[model samples]
Target chain A: MARRKGVESSIALADAVAMCKVDAISAYPITPQTHIVEHLSEWVNDGELDAEFIPVESEHSAMSAALGTSAVGARTFTATSSQGLALMHEILFIAPAMRLPVVMAVANRSLSGPISIWNDHSDIMAERDIGWIQIFAENGQECFDLTPACFKIAEDKRVILPTILNFDGFIVSHMIEPIEYWEQETFDKFLPEFEPQIRLDVKNPSTMGAVGVPEIYYEARMAQHMALVNSKPVIKEVFAEVSQITGREYKVVESYNMEKAEVALVMMGSLTETAMTAVNNLKAKGIEVGIVRPRLWRPFPTEEFLEVLGDISVIGCVDRAYTFGAASHPVASEVKSVLYTSDKRPQVREYVMGIGGRDVRIEEIEDMFMQLIEVKNTGKDFPIQYIGVRE
Target chain B: MEHLNVFASKLVPGRELFSPGHKACQGCAPALALRYLLKAAGPNTVVANATGCMEIISSAYPDIAWGVPWIHVAFENAAAVASGVESGIKVLQRKGKLAPGKVNVVAIGGDGGTFDIGLQALSGMLERGHDVLYLCYDNEAYMNTGIQRSSGTPMFASTTTSPAGEKVPGQSTGKKDLAAIAAAHNVSYVATANTSYPFDFMAKVDKAFSTSGSKLIHIFAPCPTGWRCQPSDIIKLGRLASQTGLFPLYEYQDGKYTMSEDLPFLKPIEKYLKLQGRYRHLSKEQIEIIQENINQRYEWLQKLSRVSQED
Candidate 1:
């Protein structure tokens, strides 16, 4: 039996992780990501979780220690945000290249310069091509459910790659939400005991993370790339299994009322929930506006996205992070590239909004849909717009 | 010391954990030190190696020289990685996933990694009191990257980065006292060994592995290529370093200090310095300064040992 309880989203995520029976956890404290590790440490101290919680010195050590635990065939986890993620940039690539299935959660916050600690996608956008299975959560429930699912997907022998679960900082991490916590028996059956394919063992001594000479470096990287590309089906299969156990379905690309609509709004993370409400308001005004959210950001869900696009003529791609001097923002550029060879390509307009904790109200989301409708009706080209920017 | 009755080969284990056929430079003292280290640790061990000459030579993808479990994560995190390996094994053993027994977790790094870049992680692991043995092969500089000057490079020793030029004689700063730093952490064991003294080095390795808590052994490995010395003089230089009181052999255990071997009279520093091309440019005044520094350091060690004896 699963019991519904009102708790902070970070607590819910920590509780969910405890249910997975992780062997080791290494984390450093960063704002918006602290509560998750704090709760885990409490659980470990209380003897409720049978694991080692290493309070590492820095985010760099946090990830490096995770590599040690995971390489030794232990289920390892860590969490961070913003500057912490940037500090861990070096080990992030090595985790995937070594095929160590470590799970991490990122409370997506803006990077420093102005040094703001708030909800945004700037942190994760910088790590777009690090070769991890990146997933986005729309709300607290999704964050809780994805915890075990990520562990399961990562530990699967077919897909021996680390996974990153991203949710908006402060906005989703700090919110109190009603989450259905799992019972011990149900949780145990969902995620099986981790049995690693390669591990550090005395009886079967082996070498790992060897120096890749030029003769083998290319093939080694190619094998890692192909493994990630081949993990899509495994991800989908695990999601289906999770849906069966939790009775809540999950999709790589989720659409809301996109059928027979002329225009759509595209995005990710918690903003999708706000976009759903905005879509309902547009429906009341006799405007057919739909929303398309890609839950799986990596291995980019091209087929599912194209299937949902159908005959829609225009889409407003709302990105929370800027790509600086590039043609468009990160999410919008990805959308455009995915639609390049499609038979019925939609007019994708780039919109950068809610940067560095700037508020994006319901009216702002409604306005984005309205802009897309105008783009459809007038057939006019417009430059990338930065919403909520003052002149 | 009395002469041993038996040959050295008949005393230790016959099996070699660190096999031969690696791409190390001829007479590489670090490689020899590692061979002796693995022999002391036996087979039930896991090594977390930092990126350096040893990792590159031993593990080149298709070939590996280690007969024991080894991992190389990156530079500057060997101690942190070893911490993870130790903790992982502990938790798993408690959970009945692994057999209950002694499994040595060792981290190996070079002078550049230990005395400089990897110092913070080493300090963290020691302060946290992890059950690990951190072995530092002090070749004195970043020999893997063509002899750049590191903090472990002795004063007035010339490296590529600290070249002896018209204005600068050699390395300007004194060598960082890594053993003292490790002792400052209040770890259970801290020792310094030389490759030429294999029995002393292996004895320290055995003590470090047998005892609990964080332990560190700083091995003085002579780098012929980096130090611009004859490869054949590797062992002779190591011996001279100790005889000259430049690199003393000592251990700090359980709040007490003990010298491995006490010399009645110190050899002149010139005997050690004159053999190396890097020190050939040193003036008589520079040699005096270096000798004075070494004498002061050796006296400090003797004072600490005398205090322990008095107590």
Candidate 2:
């Protein structure tokens, strides 16, 4: 039986992963992400989760070990945040390129400069081209639910690519919320046993991660890229199935109060909830504003994003990570590129916000909506605004 | 066990897990080490090879030399990968996914991968006590990338990066003691082997596979191309390396050190150095320095072995 309990989001996420019955977990300690692995270790020690909890020395080894486990046809998992994710930058590419279905939870945090341990998208933004199936969770419940969904999506025969489930560090991971946990029997029926197409087995010996000569290197990469691009349908099927089982609606690109709205705030992660508050406040007044959040960030859901745009003429594309001297931020750049061929090309103004765990107040989000409205009303171009930045 | 000889090949496994027709350099000792290692490990083994000579030569996509299941993830994480493979197998067996049986998980890397870049991962695997056998083929330098110096490169041994130039001799520092480092982790088994002594290396491999916890075998694999020596003299170079006490063959097991082959009187280091072009530029003084370093290390090993014997 599924039970609802008020628990820390990290604990709930750990419980969700345990429900999936992972064969191996290789993790290192880092703030915000530490609790998830800590809870997982506790479960393993308490005999609640029957899995190998490898206390890997570093994030590089963490991901490498995961590759080892996954290559051996085991359901493997790991977690990290910020610098730990940066440390895993090299292995991250290998996981997808080799088509190992390892699932990872990234407590979204800021990258180092002055060395801050706070929430941001800079860490993941740096890994935009890693080719993993990246997803964003809005809150605790989504983090819990998305854990199994990510594993299902990653381990799906059609899409044997690694997946990363990202949730805002501290904001979601450390926050206590009432999350409904799935029963093991229910989860088992939802996500079938991991039947790997290729594995490191002694009986059927084969080489993996072999040297790709120029003759086949380009083709191998293209095949991997196509697999990810074609995984959209498979991901949608899994999402639909998850929704059916849980009695909750899930979408690749979720829109809140976009109907009859002329302007909207576009972003990802827990900030979307704050943006929702701003949307509600604006709707109460005569001014119409909405929020467009892409739950599935990678393989960017272009068609669904286009459909959600509807008649919104201007959008404040909120990005927690600044691309430093680039024309626009990571999410904004993708939004612009995806809308390039589409006829309904909305004016996407880039808004860099809440970087290094700066509080993104509801008023600030409301101001972003107001700015989007201003951009819609006036036929003027505005420079990329760094929200909450002092002059 | 008495009939275990390289010349008398009947004693070893007939099935070559590392097959022929690979693009290894002529007289590549690491390749021979792989052949011998797979023979000892047999069919029930999974190898995690680091990016180096063996990986490039053995696995070039369409043509694969490895007859057993092999994975080459990156240059620096073979041990970590092997750790994962071992853990994965254990958990799978525990969950009834795989039949309960010993599947030897071996990590293979060159000196460049094992001594320097891959050291942390190797240390972590050993510290965590993963059931793995990490085999390092120490060919002195980065032989695959055209003879660049690595930490495993012997002192005063000329390499591309550590060129014996006007003001400086080749490779300023002595070779990093990787066997001692592995021993520091208190793993169940740690051994030093030379590819020239195929029987001894294969014997160590057998012991390593039988061990339950972390094990490391550091093999002295001479690179004829990198060393600029006669390709056929690889065996002689390897033998001289051990005979001259430049690279001693020993084992550390169950908190006891034992010499695999004890020499009554060590051969001159010059005899070993004279064969390889990498050491051709060394002056008598430089040779003396190299000789002194080898003497000190070998003496320390003999003392440790003596202490173990006394206990």
**Which stretches in model 2 have alpha-carbon errors above 4 Å?**
B1-7
- lDDT scores of the candidates, listed in order: 0.91, 0.92
Docking quality tier of model 1: high
Candidate 1 lDDT over B1-311, as tens digits, reads 23443566677776889989998999899999999999999999999999999889899978899999998888999999999989999989999988889999999999999999899889988998989999999999999999999999988889999999999999999989999999999999999999999989999999998789999999999999998899999999999999999999999998999998887878999988999988999999999999999889899889998898777
Q: Tell how far residue B22 is off in model 2, in angstroms.
A: 0.6
Write down the worst ten-residue block by lDDT for model 2 chain B: B1-10
What interface Cα RMSD is found for model 1? 0.7
Per-residue lDDT of model 1, residues A279-384, tens digit only: 8998999988898999999878889889988888899899999788899899999999988977878888988888999998999999888888889989878898
The C-alpha interface RMSD of every prediction is 0.7, 0.5
- Best candidate (score: DockQ): 2
After the best TM-score superposition of candidate 1, give how far the Cα of residue A147 lies from its true spot, in angstroms. Answer: 0.4
lDDT of 2 by residue, B133-233 (tens): 99999999999999999999988889999999998888888889999999999999999999999889999999997889999999999999999999999
Give the candidate number with the greatest lDDT: 2
